[model samples]
Target: MKREVRIMNYFPGCDPTEIRMSGNYRYYLSKKGERPLIVIGMNPSLANRKRADLTVRKISKVAMLSGFDGWVMLNVHPIYSTNPKAVKPTVNNKKQLRKNLNFIREHLNKFPDAPVFVAWGKNDGVYILDTGRKMVNDLLKEMGRECYAFKLNKDNTPAHPSRLPYKIMIDAATNMNCIYKLQGS
Candidate 1:
């Protein structure tokens, strides 16, 4: 299949080099400097637009209350699809996943101590996500960094920020010291 590559635009007024495009399947960042919160979603959703999407809004709000100066959004697969099961069909490919990992790795290297959020949400199939999760876990382990989750869902995965109540989200974010659960590597 022919791949459609896309670029991730950063929030307004931020530097444009936080991320860059490669291999037509990689995601780019827009924020210029250090971000306190770094989020990892499953993959690109068709719903994404020039403006922040629902998930982004939720994350931004949480970041603000967490006393974070800024945030960067990333994905596990870096593929765009509305179907929640989209990742299952393409988990093993190296082209996109490798590039995506490289992009994410650069940011993690840049922000050595920023909090990492795994917010892929519960999907019909998590095979791809699980793989991504393990990769993230291993990376964090290797770097001696930590990962976090909101732990509000039945499956024990991080709640998609959209499903979380604004008040509860803000409340949790403010208690950064106690809110997030450690994600095992």
Candidate 2:
């Protein structure tokens, strides 16, 4: 079988259920003609009612235009039971972090060459900077592939800030000699 290029989607702690409502997201995925592997965190931000809707649309569009493949949901979204007043979290705590690392390891084993892992949200950079080096190093020891991280922000829209990160990611991917583009925008 031919090796495939997969774009892994990582949304920290966002409700995955809301993704289906976004039309733009559907359109983008349809256009890409590839199924993407989606990895979402458990404790996503619950603020900003419109945030989830907007994200779904944006991500779907970008994936389709970029010709990305299928998605895999790594960490299962948490379901709060009786205690609704529990403190909502932002960054990945130790236990959650370990779960994420384990998930990455398993996926990398399955798709050794797929380079790009897309992380949505501002804090993703912090997570990657903190744990990515160690994770990548371990992966390299077993598999020769090198994985790179990218931070995608909501400011890429016309009304928002410039899409510098997008441009940077594209440039880096193009310049790299490797067959896989391990970057996030």
Strongest candidate by lDDT: 1
lDDT of 1 by residue, 1-185 (tens): 54443344424543223444444343643444455678777765532334445666566657766677777778777765555455554534545666678778888898887877777776555666566656765665777766666545775767776667777766665654323444666
lDDT, residue 178, candidate 1: 27
In lDDT terms, how accurate is model 2?
0.34
lDDT of 2 by residue, 17-133 (tens): 322212111101111122443323222222122333333333433433344454333222122111212323335433444454555566556655545333322323344323433
Alpha-carbon lDDT, every model: 0.62, 0.34
In candidate 1, list every pair of residues with a backbone clash. 19-29
Q: What are the RMSD figures for all models against the true structure?
A: 5.2, 12.5
Worst 10 residues of 2 by lDDT: 23-32
C-alpha displacement of 93 in model 1, angstroms?
4.0
Model 1: lDDT equals 0.62
